[model samples]
Target: MTVTPDIVLVLCVLLVVIILFIIDRVRVDVVGIIVMVGLPLLGLVTPQQAVSGLSSNAVVSIIAVIIIGAGLDRTGVMNRLARLILRFAGKRESRITAMVSGTVAVISGFMQNIGAAALFMPAARRIASQTGIPVAHILLPMAYCAIIGGTLTLVGSSPLILLNDLLVVQGKSYEHFGMFSMTPIGIMLIIAALIYFYLLGKKILPGCKQIRERGPLSPLLDKTYHEVGKIYEMVIPENGFTKKSLGQLRIRANYACTVLAAYNHVTHKRIVAPLSEDELSPGDCLAVVGPPMFVEKLARDFGWIYKDELKVFADDLAPANAGIMEGIVTPRSALIGKRVGDFQFRRKYGVSPLAIFMGHEITVSDLSVQTVSEGNALLLHGKWSAFHRLKDQNDLVFTEPIRGEEIREDKATAALTCLAISLFMILVLNIQLSIALFFGALCMVLSGVLSIDEAYLSVDWMTVFLLAGLIPLGLAFENTGAAKLIADSLMHMLGVPSPIVLLASIALLTSFFTLFTSNVGATVLLVPLSMNLALSCGCDPRAAAMTVALAASNTFVLPTHQVNALIMRPAGLRPIDYLKAGAGMTIIFLIVLVAGMRIFF
Candidate 1:
């Protein structure tokens, strides 16, 4: 009858979490928040520990990661990269499937799998759209590929990396995994996944009734076009745009309008999503997008081509409206043969081209010499007003309204630059992961690829809250002896006199626990028990410890595992699908793990 106060608190928290997860009524973030704040209120952890997740370095890095991802996507960096890799995929469906999985795995092997997925998922979707390949066939494989990739290096997966550090802290340094020690097994799993997906998964990938044609971005871009900003074709007379570098103009800074592109007869140059260094010139015809007020002020200040408020069209000229519009540059149009830089398009026309499809390829690096091709497609970006104005002109072809056209060549450069610097710090300088990401995000914002406000908004608050709220519960479990209790119960029930069984049991249990919680959390709770079990069973504690670390990644089923969840919905897969697809991979991984142990130990 004399239950410890700690037990009551721990048990109460567990019961509450299970109930909340089952009901699924309250949001997951809310559930985490309750556990975070409730534990301390019930006298389990200190108030500091309860709110610790909010201040954790991991939380900040995660936020930075999301912002970094947004910068990459918004700037078309990922798109450009995806296009390059996908080009080699070939036309064969099987080849495409194999190539996509292989590329994602290689990228994921070096970076966080989630970030790698974010970079390539769109390309997979785009490939599906362009080639008539089923998205369902590729999305799930993409997720699995990334998961498998993480097993390759020391830092590939957090749990694996963190497990070593945790062991060192516990004074079990002798029994640790080296940086590339995981390569053998990790490669085995990755190869197995690739082969399986190509031979079996690709062939059987469902028609997925859930796949929306063109994937999620097209429709999102469609809806967001009219929902975000006003696009205007504003003229920039001598004083307004001439002689100031777009960076100096700080149009986005001072005027809040992006100079999508520009052309001027004065310079015979055109600017396409010109970087900050590209300057403006007199008589520049600029295309810009901004708030209605900024657009109007800009026009009044410059006296460029602008809509007369009284003489409007079908859609309102109010700045509140936003959408994607396209226009063709005609031979008669003054913009013809102009260097993009001459007009400060953003400063004049008030719109930018998302893509410039032409018969001849214009290397992006050759932007300086690139002229406006006479018969090319200019995927213009800006307000509905800009499109309307472009339409009335004698020179260009205007296409139907489109959405999601905010790609920037300059921003893409910024993303690449940021990623490059971060990678250097991480791989060359050996900087901590969180610090590397934080610094990279700062560089992204400062470089003008990602603005501060955009970075803040880019964060997925739900995931943040969930991370912040649930992290402290790990402390509660340890403090309350729940970890010990579980270890003892397992030892008595399944911990036979044999070391091999003990090792297998520990590894299996750790993998099972990761299905629901994070591998990091699972590792933290299981490390103590696993280490104790190893010693008591007379097992090589190092072998047993590493087994647990490897098992943490065996989080095969359950969308609850974020890695599995990454492409879950987009892949049009349900929980049952994950169980079916992942089970094979999990079994393959564990089998290799055991074999590797026997062979290496």
Candidate 2:
């Protein structure tokens, strides 16, 4: 194949994309947008072809899958799954690892792997706290399984979903893969990962002695605030205490105690950071944080029953549900140049201040009237839901990882029904994958499983645009003969190798490439070339394309994959930890992948 000017231009663009991705300074999405516009300007692809990726089936399917996952999450499906896993797992560390990691792998077979990993993170931490197991042992296996789980279905991951679309673009002879076309391979891989972790995990995985103590309140806070960060539960006296607002009682002003959460027995509702004017009724339970002596004194004076353990609000106040976060006052914050109480910090934001760290001084007393300034770091205590809402605002720049959302248990059945219908459409009706998935997402919005706004927020636009923008680049590679040229050069370099050797080479190359760039990027760049290489060697081009997509998920040797990065800091994992554990996983994945392709396809 002759390399034309267009091929040179495409190669140049491909090289720039690789370098920009490696440097990691520019946002990956921005790199995508640059390609989207740059290609049309350079005359390699027509303007229409450049914009066509946005309307591609792969992009639409990803958006729909994300929305459906969000609807499930909003309605408490994942939470219920977590509870069931814990119930069956018991206190056995090995059982907990297998159960949790296996479940996440199955969940990830349909939705984005990162989302599945993230949804299970708090649950993993909770398990560690309860079982005295270091989180590192659980997280590495879970992350690896989540990545490999993408091979379970066509829509399980972006690379797999894009495979059929890329094949369709390759020409009409290549047919699309069914939803479960890759199921056998995915199951084998997941089982291999589970068994690997079960036998060798304790020896290979990193150890964090402080992981158990690093619950929601965190060991850092316990060391920094000492008694002030100690949490206690209090019950209002049934007959002696009258219905009085918190402000009237001056709980913070007099006793320096902050009510972090309140549970109303009458309404059966839980409120976090209740306003000062919110009345405290008899027999209500309060989750408070303060100095031990002061809390004890306040409890004695009010004839309240106080317990050191958070038994009543234990689940609700667990690290997974609620926790303390540090928020720095931004220069643009409305709280700047005013006292903390001026905005009714607790009432408006649903968060109560625990301490203020300004410069080198830390103050925990009289926080309500404390003057806020730019760069002042305020330690706030509240539910994770409140922090999730505040994360979008510019008032405070949260320094900690914020996760978890409030669940709508009432809509769980509706969400499950939508998912079931979507599956039925795909399996029974033989409808288009994009149309069927989007139909389910629409049903979710209509059924109140998720609001329209929530559905929109659920999508990771970065992943969508990255896949969409790169589609045309793949098209250009084929159009300009760039892919065929590279294929010829590779074949010439190997001097007409056998089909199996060629396949292994292709898989290994794709796996290595994915470690640096996004898996989506690796898939788009390699599929066309691999298909061309396969055709030249008289091998099945579809099998070669499948190898590219599957191999892209074999990114275990590094923490570049989104799932690995998400669990790294929380699990206290280092690069060496990944290297030691992932080395074995990567090898196992390749062996299973090559053998499965030869056997199944």
Candidate 3:
């Protein structure tokens, strides 16, 4: 093969892109955009070709897949799956780890692996709290399995979904892969991972101490707000404060007491974070958190019956349903410079402000009147559902991971039907993958499973644009004969190795590329090269191209992968920890990948 000026320029651009990716200063998506614009500037690809990736089949399919996943999430399908896993997981650490990790692995075969890992993270933490296992032991295994599980189906990972497109662009006689073409090898890899973790986890996994079984966030809440106040229940007498709304009494303003929940004994009604206009009728029970002296004074002055224990409000105000949480006001929050009372925080957000930790000061009184600022940590008490809603908003961010019943359980069946329709179209009807998935996503929006805004919010636009921008780079590799140049160089170095050796080498190279750069970048850069290499060595080009696609998901030795980074902060994991576990997993991944390719393909 002859190396030309176009090939040299393409290689130079590729080198710069890889260096920029490794430097980690600029965002990966920005690097992708650089590739998108840089190639056209260099005249390596035409303007039309440069922008072709934005409308490509792979990018469209990924968008649809994300929306479909969100629809299922909104309808509580993942939550139900988590519950089913817990029902059978038992109390053993190894069993729980295997069950959760395996289930996530299988789920990742259909949707984005990072999404699958995130969906199961809270469940893994819940299991760790219940089973006396350190979350460190469970999270890494789950993350690892999720990465491996992406190999199960074509649409499972970005790389695999982009494979057919790259192959066709190679303009070879290669056939496109079916959705489940890689399932046999993927199943083998998943089983191998489960067995490896179950057998050697205690020896190799991190040994971080377990948090309190009550839930990790509980202790943090107690330590931070222990000085704020104590929870007390009070009952209203027959004629005490009759027909007077809570606003008229001005309890928070005068007494520094916040009513968290109200239970009416006569109507058997429970209102959490009751509005200011809610009337204080006789025989109503109030769940309030305040200073003991202030609470006693209110009881004495108003002739209200006081109780040392929460009897009627116990279930309503239980830790599982309602508790104190720390919420940090985002820098771009709408609430900035405004008082908490300006937005009617209690009525709108369904959370009561207990104390504001601003700078070094902790303000407990007149919380509604206190001005809000960026990064102000507000200690709030409310139902988990309220915190969950706040998480969706950008103004206030919760510090702790919350488990709440926020899913629309009523739309679950509709979501499932939509998913079934998508699958049927793909497997039976033989429709285009992107078209089938998009139709399913449209069904989700039309069926009231998810609002249009929610569907749009579900997409990680960065990933979409990254894939879109990098596609043209792969086209340049093929169009400029850069792929052929590199393939000939590699073939000369290897001195005509066997077909299996060729496939293994391609897998190893792709695995290394994905660790420093992104899996998507690695796939786009290598698929064309792999096809050329296979042809040069008299090997099966399809197998070689597939090798590059599958190996892209084998990045576990670093925290560079999205799933690894997602779990790192929560698990208190460091680089050395990933190296410890990922080394063995990486070796196993290669072994299974090579052997499975030889046997299956």
Candidate 3 lDDT for residue 300: 88
Clashes of 2: 0
Best by TM-score: 1
Considering summed lDDT, which 10 consecutive residues are worst modelled in model 3?
209-218
Relative to the unseen true structure, what is the C-alpha lDDT of residue 371 in candidate 2, on a scale of 0 to 100?
91
Q: Model 2's lDDT to the true fold?
A: 0.79
TM-scores of the candidates in the order shown: 0.63, 0.58, 0.58
Give the CA lDDT, 0 to 100, for residue 263 in model 1: 65
lDDT string, candidate 1, 200-224, tens digits: 7743465454333231113434453
The Cα local distance difference test for each model comes to 0.65, 0.79, 0.78
Per-residue lDDT of 452-562 in model 2, one digit per residue for the tens? Answer: 999998777776676667667766776777665765576578655677787787888788767644567668878887787778777888988999999888988655566
What is the lDDT, from 0 to 100, of the residue 421 in candidate 2? 89
> Tens-digit lDDT track for model 3 on 29-73?
677688889899999999998888788776787677668877776
- Cα distance off (Å), candidate 1, residue 182: 2.3
